[model samples]
Target: MLHLITYKYNFIPAGEQALHIVFPEQINISENQLIQELASQLRDSYEDEITDIAPAYRTLTVYFDIRKTNYFKFSNKLKKFLVNYTLEKKNTYGRTFEIPVCYDLEFGIDLADVASFGKLSIPELIEIHSSTRYFIYMMGFLPGFAFMGNVPDQIAMARLEVPRSSIAPGSVAIAGKQAGIYPVASPGGWRILGRTPVTLYTPDNPLPPFQAGDSIKFKQITRADYEAIKELDAHGEYQLKVL
Candidate 1:
């Protein structure tokens, strides 16, 4: 007999037209997968009534059309479909991305500060960060800004008390348990330790490069490699490796 796993979730009204379907407030992969599956089920069942479905760490916010469907109608519709829904049987280990990050002083202004704060050498800090594979929990703050998780406790630090006015694009930063790249030149408070040459935000591409439930590994590179990749990337010739 095939054993099936069904998870329970909560559907709460976020706004007049938005509903938030949430799993337990934790950072487990199973909870994230359940949230993703819930978003998937909603799209499959209510394709016309739903305008947008956004998944986060443990919650999936569904935006619906008020003119066509309200909370009462939506809940009833979900109950019917969810009873028959089963989790997909496939690999969810997630893709491993070899993102090239340049840790030179020019790109990583806060490298020394972060290293000093962690009571480690710059090389030690980079090695620890590069070796660990990070999980993609959610994408938020800005388009393509992926909120990845579980920065090794040794180097994890709190966000800056005062945020910078503007941070350069491609800056790889970490604060608390989360790490992310600044997809655009935006104001931020995270501790920047390096920068990747890869372009994260692609408006022309329908789907963003990174999605929730993905994984990332940073590969250390020199400044020369960063310049080379940047040039090729500008011409649309560079391709990032995924394993």
Candidate 2:
């Protein structure tokens, strides 16, 4: 017996040899978890044109093969699955990562300001930021950089008015309602409270340390240790990036 539920879909002719499933607004109810779990189910039930599935803010987009599966049957089956969807609130689909950060002046250019804005001293900032466990909402903008958040309101801040043209890789930053690690060297606007030793965007790597619904923690490390990790990472034989 199917319950009362509704879904809307669109078809796209992509060159990748697969149909795309777009759940744009349907994300608000039960997002990443729903997409991942539901995708597993739908993929198992239907064996056609499924290249990959990507989940974003309140939306899930899947790529599939059009010839193997027509849109009508695909939509019907997906609609039924969604109507009977069983949402699961979970901690992580990937791995919980403990990252080391150096709030030292050499790397952290905005720490003092962030501390001042939050009315906390340097040590207080460290304690507050490191103590709290954050939720990883999604990974985008660049590889390995998880769009994460839910920082306790007390420490939240708005993004920089003028986005920086170049931010060093491995920067750890925060913004309105969220905080995250910078995975690559790129233009960014997030206020950096510190810098982590973790290398997030590794070209040719399929998965980063984070995935949707993952949890991240900040651990304090001395500047010396940060440099040592940098050296080790440069050698390319270390496991700096985790599940």
Candidate 3:
């Protein structure tokens, strides 16, 4: 149900200019879209005060200028406005991102383990992961980390017992039913199958290259292609070119 209650919050003191609250339920893809939409509304109205809106698995934190924006007042306004915030089941938008995966034995470090767990051949594992389409649920844990969903039923697997020291960027890894890209080089536990050429995170770029509610389609590439892409990246001209 959509919330209509004019939330009266003493949660903020007079001196406080900003506030943050965590919701009880973990937010999935569509729910995040709603939070962003609501924040967009506030942004349109009070461009100066509402500095930014961040969405997570189950919560949204809004940042604003306390000197320019009243914390309690803005909270009450949002509560009342979102009473009709499209609570009904809605559709997730857009075309599928055909991300190319270089699944040569070298890149797919955990391909054998995944095949063993699923009782499938290595070729079978690659076939399954590439054929399926996934929906992005959230973007967090790190910048541009697209928490996409619904790996093939047969391909579902658990994270490694211990996280890796560092996963290569563009690594398409699956932990439980959720899968994600490394975005930037970082430590993770997800069973990495292959690396993509996609540049998921770039600091100099304005706005992240991705957003909530995007689709993903994995395609296979070769070791040579991976090396070529790596070389391009070394020269700082990286771009995901599907083969």
Candidate 4:
């Protein structure tokens, strides 16, 4: 049976322990914002019963304790609350951060290829990329890998035709409309343009420093600057300012 909560969503059970609130099939900024707000409301209201509330691109997962609340009663109550939920007129602009990146060939193996693909000079590509402020749409695919969006059209290009076996940790790359840094060494397809020296994830911190809805700006630096920051980062002395 199809259970529609509103014109924009349908609620489906994800087993006896959770429910998935799905939005429109298409990916849009407004739809994502709506999901974020809805997930925030669920967490605020049902903190005791909910074990977790996670929002992805367009779906909100509400995880609850089966021992504390049955799916039937809990889902019904959630549906009713959502039916009356109103998205606030004022937008919540999350924290802004500036990440330092060094785009020298030594760190950016695919830089030449990416520049050629975009029909841009290496300097031109870096200028366009660093000038734009990106929005953090979601953080997944790996721990602390922020899925930021809206890379400039001039520099926006498709991912590599073939995925690389592995990319270095802190490698900054872009694919489609999104850009992100590899927090750990792993296989990926995104075209590499640069690398940041910041440590985005660590066992010492339970959660990543940034969250979804945050804004990020890429600040370009010289290769010398990258090495300096890298040394500080390695020794736990580098500090990234958040506004």
Which consecutive 10 residues in model 1 have the weakest lDDT in total? Answer: 1-10
Model 4 stretches astray by more than 4 angstroms: 1-7, 90-92
Score each candidate by Cα lDDT. Answer: 0.83, 0.70, 0.71, 0.83
Judged by lDDT against the true structure, how good is candidate 2? 0.70
Q: What digit string (tens of lDDT, one per residue) describes model 1 on residues 1-243?
A: 111235556779888898887667777776676667668778887899999999999888889999998988886777676667676654465777778999998888888887887899999999988998888888888988888877988889888999999999899999978889898899999999899988888678534566887888899999999999999988989887897
Q: Can you give the lDDT of residue 136 in candidate 2?
A: 72
Error of 2 at 211 (Å): 2.7
Please give the distance, in angstroms, between residue 186's alpha carbon in candidate 1 and its true position after superposition: 0.6
**lDDT-based ranking, best first?**
4, 1, 3, 2
Which whole-number lDDT from 0 to 100 does residue 68 have in model 2? 71
- lDDT, candidate 1, equals 0.83
Worst 10 residues of 4 by lDDT: 1-10
Clash pairs (backbone) in predicted model 2: 18-64, 18-65, 19-64, 27-58, 49-64, 49-65
Please give the lDDT score at residue 135 for candidate 1. 86
Question: For model 3, where is the 10-residue window of minimal lDDT?
Answer: 4-13
Instruction: Using lDDT as the measure, name the better of candidate 2 and candidate 3.
Output: 3
